[model samples]
Target chain A: MKNVRLNALLAMGLIIVMILSLAAGKVWVSPAAWLGDDLSALIIMELRLPRTVLGAAIGAALGMAGATMQGYLRNPLADPGVFGVSASAALGAVTSLYFGYAVTAWLLPAFALAGAGIGMGLLALLAGRSGSLILFTLAGVILSSLAGSLTSLMISLAPTPFATTEIVTWLMGALTDRSWDDVQLAVPIIAAGMVFLFATGRSLDALTLGEDAARSMGVNISRLQWFAVLGVGLTVGASVAAAGIIGFVGLIVPHLVRPFAGHQPSAVLLPSALAGALLVVGADSIVRILPSVSELRLGIAMSLLGAPFFMALLFKMHRELS
Target chain B: MLLSFENLSLTLRGRKILDTISGQFQPGRVTVILGANGAGKSSLLSCLSGLREPKSGSVTLDDRALLSLNGKKRGRMIGLLPQRPDIHWNVDVRTIVGLGRLPHSGRWGMSAADHDAVARAMEATDCADLAERKAMRLSGGEQGRVLLARVLAGEPQWLLADEPLASLDPAHQFDVLERLKNYAAAGKGVIVVLHDLTQAARFADDIMVMKEGAILAAGPRNEVMTADIMAQAYGVEVQIGTSDTGEPLVVPVRRL
Candidate 1:
């Protein structure tokens, strides 16, 4: 019941924001922009439509990735941002770009996808081998910090300051000046990851009771872990490559949406996707509309709101532990 | 067709958790594994539940080898409730209970039969009243019962629980044990690893006393609960008395 209501609200909100995102941007194309009319087609089809779709797809992917990892590990704090998958993917994209490997738009995200695979591989080899989530979280902290420092060091050693600054902005995150090609690259990867993660919703639900019980219920623990890692890696990694490591979309969207979804991990999955799409769209729209903040990226908007949220979660966890 | 452990042995971190031991679990009878702390009771349960593979033995359910079966298939036949289950997310009680219905459901959603199973299991565990409550907000006993509902709803042929009553109050403890007792009476094989000798003696059709990674005694409760075997297993003297309900009640001398 709660799920039905929330899905309806989300569907409505998404439709409104999507319309606003396309219609209210700097181009200010008329309502006819949605149709394939030439002038409006150049603005809407050639630009805003693709951007809006990309934003929603990446948002849904990141949201589902975050939801899957948290659900599987049984920890709310296990987002790609906090655990470092985003930074790792960024490092991969930036390094590939630094090496002139991203001459094509597809190459950067493709390389970023590979980087996410590496990140997840390392995580599974270290974290999944353990029988406990606490151990996994600790391992993630160490790996993420190491990845962050390595990224910083690479940026410092970079030869061209112009490209270095670009990389930094990308790492900090953005969804600005993205072309239709960027949308084309992100849509399929995110869509695939979303499908796989959603397929395992029942498995994630069983896992919350812990591994032993989950296994007895016929959940292949190791295989399920691998699937979750794959889901998070592809979705989050693809998003990082496309949108430059947009922070908090994956973490906070699920936190807000899960309650209304009745806390069923499976129910949380798709709604999380919808909420994720909605958040990025809303954030991107804000970035486009705010007059003085034309330079503001979606990442900046989210960080402004998300940093306090990170602190709140930490404080809340501390209180709960106490 | 009974579940049996053949020459099961496990060594973890260079120490034997379960020394080479052999046992059989008869169908339609409850096997209660009773032992003191550090006596490897939990490890034994883990082996049977396929959470941990025995280093040098096999767990067989009928003609099928548990070690060979994947986690999903084995889980269908074996319902296990481990000690101290914790939730990372705040989910509804019914949602948690519905998890037991996973083995019966497909990827897209649960069927009507699955929902019916959830409702019936919740009703059986006395958690239907609290179905709308958040799982993390429930009392430890309530959470435990909810998990029991989750396990019970799975309807596995063999139910293995490690210290199911460890944190429950007396009334809840009775509630949980009686449910297990009823499950066994219905011709399901239920193995409860317990520390409370009195509960084991009263409810177990068959009891095995484990000590030092091996079985000290194994038989019907009357045959297995001799004072000497209890002393060896628990490292204390046990005095047996009859309850008002004519079940065995155990009193242990304090270890000073």
Candidate 2:
């Protein structure tokens, strides 16, 4: 019942934020004018709607990815950002651009997906299955640096100055100018990733007792690990391909929702995904309404919001431990 | 049903943890495995519980290969309570205990049977009152009992526990041992890895002593609890006496 209520509340909040995302942009797309054949309606249909939908999908993906990683790794600090999964995806996306293959459509995200998959595979090889927390963290840091440098190398070697600017802006993360094509590209992959993540709910709960205990409870740890890592790779890769590196949505959403949703990883997943969608759409809306001459970057806005929350969480954990 | 291992051996980090060993455990008997430190007690438990695979041997449950069974089916048949029962989160005690029913619970979560099992296990382990408390806040002994309760909730046919009484107080220790003995009495196999020989002598129907990754001696408690076997396994001279309750008592006099 509480789970249902929490899901409902998050769903409601997401709906509200999504609607506000459509209406809060530079254009005054009122509810009455939303479906008419007027230019305002066309703007809503062609522009804001796709952007809002993408925002929600990306947010949900990040949130679910974060929750799944944290639950599977049994560490609250685990996230796609920390694990270099997103960095590798960004590197892959940048490589696609550097090779001018992104103009072909579909290739960009495919490459990004491949990069993310390799990243997770390498992490598994380096860290081993059920790696200790320190070893996993160390492996993640190493991978992140490697991917970051690769991305930088690609950016530096780009033939055209236009490519550099485009890459930089994309890396800043944005929801602007996203069409139905972008939405169509990212949603199916993100949805598939979400399915894998959602399926892990009960297994993650069983895993809270540590791996051996969880295995005794019939959780196939290897399968669970593969599903979770694959799910995060797909979602984070697709999100990065579509919107660049949107930092901290995955990290923030689970932490934000965990208190109300309870600590059960399965119980916390949906609420975290919903809250993530709400957060991304809301943040996207907030940035559009800001007075800056240029719209604030979605990734930057999330960091601005998420870093403080992360600090507060750290302090809370520290106090509790002490 | 018979739980048997044949020529089981395991190596970890290039160090032999369990040498070629053969053993059989029967239901309706409390089998206590006694060993000194680094005696591969935990390794033996892990292999029995299907948490580890032997290098070149077979573990069979009632004539079927143990490793061939699916994890859930295997889980429903055999349960293991690990040492140092670590709970990653501050989950409520009921939820922690409910986790044991994962093998039984369906996609929709706990059923009536699961709930009853959880409740019954908690009551038997004397952890019913701690159901609402956060699992991480409990003392070592309380955590041990809660973990045992979690394992009991699974209603497994075979129970393997590793160092369950190391941190527990004497009262809780006896309470836990009595419960385990009762579980065996109810026709389930109970295999416990213990350091304290007196407790093993008191409660174990069968005792197997291990040293340096090999079984030194194994038999009925009376047959295996002699002073010579105890001294050889533990490397100490020990006094063997009868307790007030007519149980065997092992008191370490000095190192050999």
Instruction: Tell me the lDDT of candidate 2.
Output: 0.89
Q: Can you tell me the DockQ of model 2?
A: 0.78
Cα lDDT of model 1 by residue, B1-256, tens digit: 4888888999999999899898888768888999878888899888898888889998898878888886666777888888877665688898888888777777666789888888988988999899989999999999999999998888888999888998899898999999998888888899999888888888888998888899888999899988888877777888999978887889897652
Going through the candidates in order, state the TM-score of chain A alone for each one.
Answer: 0.93, 0.96
Name the regions of candidate 2 deviating beyond 4 angstroms.
none
Most DockQ-accurate candidate: 2
Worst ten-residue run, lDDT, model 1 chain B?
B101-110
Clashing pairs in 1: A216-B75, A218-B72
Please write out the lDDT profile of model 2 over residues A83-190, one tens digit for every residue. Answer: 898899999988988888889999999989988878876776676366468888999999999999988998899899989988888888898999999999999999
Report every candidate's CA lDDT.
0.83, 0.89
